[model samples]
Target: MGAWSRLKEAFTREANISSPEDLLAQARGMRNGKVPVTKDTALRNSAVWACLRLRADLMSSFPIDVYRYVNGIQIEVPKPPVLVSPGGTEVGMREWMYSTEFDLDRGGNCFGVITERSGVIGPDGRGLPGRIELVELGAVAIRGNGSTITKFIINGAEYDPWEVWHEKQYTVAGVPLGLSPVAYAAWVIEETLSAQQFARDWFAGGAVPLAELKNNAKVVNAKDARVARDQFRAAVDDSGLFVHGMDWEYKPIQAVASQSAFIEARQYGASEIARFFGCPGDLIDVAVSGSSITYASMTQRNLQFLIMNLGPAVGRREDAFSRRLVSGPRFVKFNTDALLRMDPEARARTIGARITNRTLAPSEARALDNLPPFTEDQLSEFDRLFGSRSVPAQPTTAVPGATP
Candidate 1:
């Protein structure tokens, strides 16, 4: 066909296409209307940093323990080789958890590779994994149907779903892919960045001072104007002084709004980011005013945070670790009590109450405090101090002396 004829035919074919595949193709070719926010841009906002860092630090620092079920009771067990030291590096369990949580919170997913080696068998004769290597989320890709991951592509190598450890949050469209909070809250982030940039430029340009050169005869040329502008800049550049030639007037430009306005805008953005992450604004140093709610102590606030905000994320991590790292009745859990650590006085009261109510033994309470169990002598001493007192005969004589 002739070139023009071929082009005409292409247009006709495109006009007639009406398949689902065609629609998908068109959608893929088009750009999304929303502002695009990458991980770097999202982290530029202080609020995003506070929200993500707070959660990552808390989640990672919380103590994690592996337990085995014996006779319907859970007993703490030694951490597996995989859990004690992951990624085949010096990264400990806490650091690994922090990185995983940070990746999930920022990018919506985290990936790791399980390494196996020969001649490294457990007592049961099963080969234990040599190491677990964390992979950057950007370097990993997923291929599967809507419901499950069929394969993972990591650093140019393909892996089976079972060979890769994956954790994700808030899947989209029945797929296990996670949706990043940065992508959803891009508009706010953009506004915050713009406001900050404006403030920075305002201060950087000598606070936007203006120069007015009065030519009485109105005969100044472009050269004169250029010269005047250069002279003004040179004087004010780091000197904070402006000198002009004859008939020139210098007037500082007043800002349309005060610096506090921009400050408030940035503060609002921080709160919004915290809200998006379901974190408390006050925890991130965002001021809260005119509020009736009050926490008598930090413990109460932390308890509220755990119960309302961080609890679900912790539970999700525990479930993921338990399923991926253990077999049968063995499980993994984060000891959330670590986050609720109390002052010595409060801890004493709590443990004392538990011991008094018989819900917790003295030895168990001591162990919880990282103290060694009591010996026989110490146990006898505790019994002497707290044991019940015997009733004396004076009580009988108090009954009106009738039974003397």
Candidate 2:
């Protein structure tokens, strides 16, 4: 078969697997073809670090809350069991979110074991899964194909699909497993690693200095070459001098292009990786010079991030949690306001605008500021101080004409 025909056949074969074991075997075979990029090595790339950190940290910082719908309005309930103590130990909601997001970003999948639950009570009651334990992606395996997940294998133990929670990123048709960004972008990451290694090795090897012996002489054997190399190293190391015949020459290999070329290559790699992960290049410290994109303020940038990057992911999580943890009318939500919090000045401006438009009440604004509503005495004082100024005086046109 021609190369193109073989490539088409491989894709067709992968897309035709209908058995659970066949899907698992295909995933394992693909994984075995290359050294899987571990979380540690992936983080060494600045782009990966920036992308994962920004996403995980921001998502984790948000408050995960449970609420119930009543009369078409949502009311937040007291801390739900899932949100109050997700991992059962020191790991709470924030840590749970962080770990899940980290896994999703690194491995395109997040797995957690749901342990313990309580009978469904009133809308205000706590949600199910009294305790949840995060499972490392490396330790989890998909055991079925198609929409129905039969089981999950964690640490060599088989778990019913319903017993575990799973979140996945990009998925291909006929594949039940999530597709990892690192695996898809392996070539770019490898190039970046190689470039960094080259630079390090270059510096470690005395910056590429070359030496020529007198009269074009050459070492006759490996032992002679070793002795000559040691002598050269000794002279250079001890006195920064090379004792040689008058005809000896020393030269250094200079890069054809400026060092900036290497820097540009690395920068390009970072941008490529950021694109692969659906992150803005600038968020990962990839310079955005000469770009048309601009943000009027930090608030605008955050809003853009929410709409363009995190909106879908947040929706998926909310749906998953609602289906698994809550009963009718009750739903799980992450308070994204926590992530979009503004500076004091910006916050004040927003609140002021809302109040002026009468869309928000003064008491509600005060509550948002963590302050109690004004007491009757305080209200009276406020009236005394500013109420008179707000009330306009009656017009005195006749009196003004008489005075003129």
- Which RMSD does model 2 reach against the true structure? 9.0
TM-score of 2: 0.81
The whole-model lDDT of each prediction reads 0.69, 0.68
Q: Give residue 113's lDDT in candidate 2 (0 to 100).
A: 86
All candidates' TM-scores?
0.77, 0.81
Q: Model 1, residue 125: displacement in angstroms?
A: 15
Model 1 — which ten-residue stretch has the worst lDDT? 395-404
| Model 2 Cα lDDT, one tens digit per residue, 80-198 | 67777788868887888899998887777788887866676434454356677897766776444344456677887878765787777766554455667776676677677767766
lDDT of 1 by residue, 53-137 (tens): 9999999888778888789867878777678777656878888889999888877778888776324443345554556788876
**Which segments of model 1 are wrong by more than 4 Å?**
1-36, 117-130, 206-223, 233-246, 256-258, 373-404
Model 2 gets an lDDT of 0.68
**How well does candidate 2 score on lDDT at residue 293?**
78
Misplaced by over 4 Å in model 2 are 1-40, 121-127, 145-147, 206-227, 238-240, 256-258, 387-404
